[model samples]
Target: MHDDAHAAGVTRAGAAFAARRAELRMTVQDVVDSGALSKSALVNFENGRTWPRDGNRDKLERLVGLEEGALTSLYEQGAGMSRQDQTEGLVRAGAAFAKRRDDLNITQVEVAEQKIMSVQALIAFEKGRSWPREMRRAELERLVRWPPGTLASLRNAAATPSPDLDGVSAEPPADPSTLMLDAVKLALTSALDKLKALPADDAPTFIAEARPVMASLRSLQALASRAVRANIGSVSAVQTLEDITACFEDLMGRVAAHPAASLGQKLYVARRKRHLNVQEVADILDMPATTVAAVEADEQELSDDYRERVEQLIRTLTFLKL
Candidate 1:
């Protein structure tokens, strides 16, 4: 899965590198000479063979001059030699990173020279197979800025287990709560806009990420609404979150209710939050011009081709300036 993501990111990097190479009109030999690395190594790198290394990064940077950027991160992550494991306590392979250092489990110093501490630890630690001590846990955690639950896991590697979506994204989620809200918002907006055209992959991915947030919001909403009914709290404190929950729910409903949106509408929502002209939208939906006009003006009842699309368009575009 991480490999899939790495592949996707590296695909982007390959394009970037090729574009830079073309822009500079520098051939394989130019990089070999400029980077002072082996010609075969340079060729292999350009041809997607060699992995990006810290030692070689400076030379590459000097050679390419980073027109927009190099694919260093993706390049390194993709390389088998630099393969990171269990990034930030998200164990790469459970057995691989559970190495014991004496009575305590710690091996960061051994791989301290590596760029990603968590990955290095997992790779080396997995090679050992034992639990780390509390102090070692704290040190490694602070050393890597691990997630909230990892301290306990480090203390008793026997207890805490990694979870799905744990290392799904290596980037620390800005906020778990915020992440959920944003995922829901993203799914809703994406669904409303892309509709059936939404990649089967993307829609599900968004929903999976956002489900936790949505569930949490619903639970909170229920609790708060009950609280309001119970008179356990004042209106001011819970009021803000309560209002936000309502808006979030309503937004989710609109998105889920109609899953088949048009390309124009989706692009519009993504860009200007404005609907295209009736004819353009009609082209997107493969509907009649008159149907589009009637749908847009709300004269026609929402139906198969236009039903969800028009309403979604209105929802996204009605208040938007563009």
Candidate 2:
């Protein structure tokens, strides 16, 4: 218990340095630019449970205005440890920042409304003392960017402004078949974005997630591609569009209903940790770029060669993560 208290106090000082320095009107970007350190490196230092030394302290002091004794105390308290431990300060800072918002003189409701989070949740986050994880800190970090900040992204989610689904009826017949088209189109767009964002080393996990969904998407693409190739009459094209939509609902149903979701989640976790790119996996299998469309839907049957390629991609990811 004594040791835990000591560790918490050390952690708290690191937290205090970040909170106080920023309170003194210094911005993180200011520190990053002046110190010529990568934003992440500075983030790591300010977020450390202990302070960084070996000249980093000098740079930080120049940015935030700390005296020698204060710097030494903070550094000794928070400097060396696991990244997970270091990152906790960011979480703690986020929570602490929220707690003090009232002293900064803002109402919880206003903060919640601004951040697109429930007031209750805002309360929980500020009060919760459990370990902080990346996802949890992400929103908090965004909020802390502005003194008494809020996340625009979360607010935007709330303001998602309904899309014009009326146009959807023109392309697909209004029925259960319509669902398939909708799901496929959504997944297709998602996969394309993922491919564009990730590189080879960053692709495997995404590919694994897409592997099952991709197959179905490809089959749809193949069918859609075939429709264009067949030169179906303009009038008949409407029916083709409707047929495509049917295929979409049929495929998504399977993907969402069963083991597919579990598999995709496992793959997503692997991809996130390994930083693997699905595009690389597709290339390895000699798949075309259109394959990106298929992956998000998990539509591919995966030829034996492709399956082996996927296995190799997974192996590569495991090694990278290590």
- Per lDDT, the best of the predicted structures is 2
What TM-score does model 2 achieve against the real structure? 0.30
lDDT of 1 by residue, 216-241 (tens): 34334433444454444555425644
Model 2, 126-242: lDDT tens digits are 654433332233334433444312321221122223567776665645543344445435545654564345333234354344333334343345434434445435444455546
lDDT of each: 0.43, 0.46
State the TM-score for model 1. 0.22
TM-score of each: 0.22, 0.30
Quote the positional error of residue 78 for candidate 2 in Å. 6.9
Worst 10 residues of 1 by lDDT: 80-89
Report residue 221 deviation for candidate 2 (angstroms).
60
Q: What residue runs in model 2 are displaced by over 4 Å at the alpha carbon?
A: 1-10, 75-109, 130-322
> lDDT score of model 1?
0.43
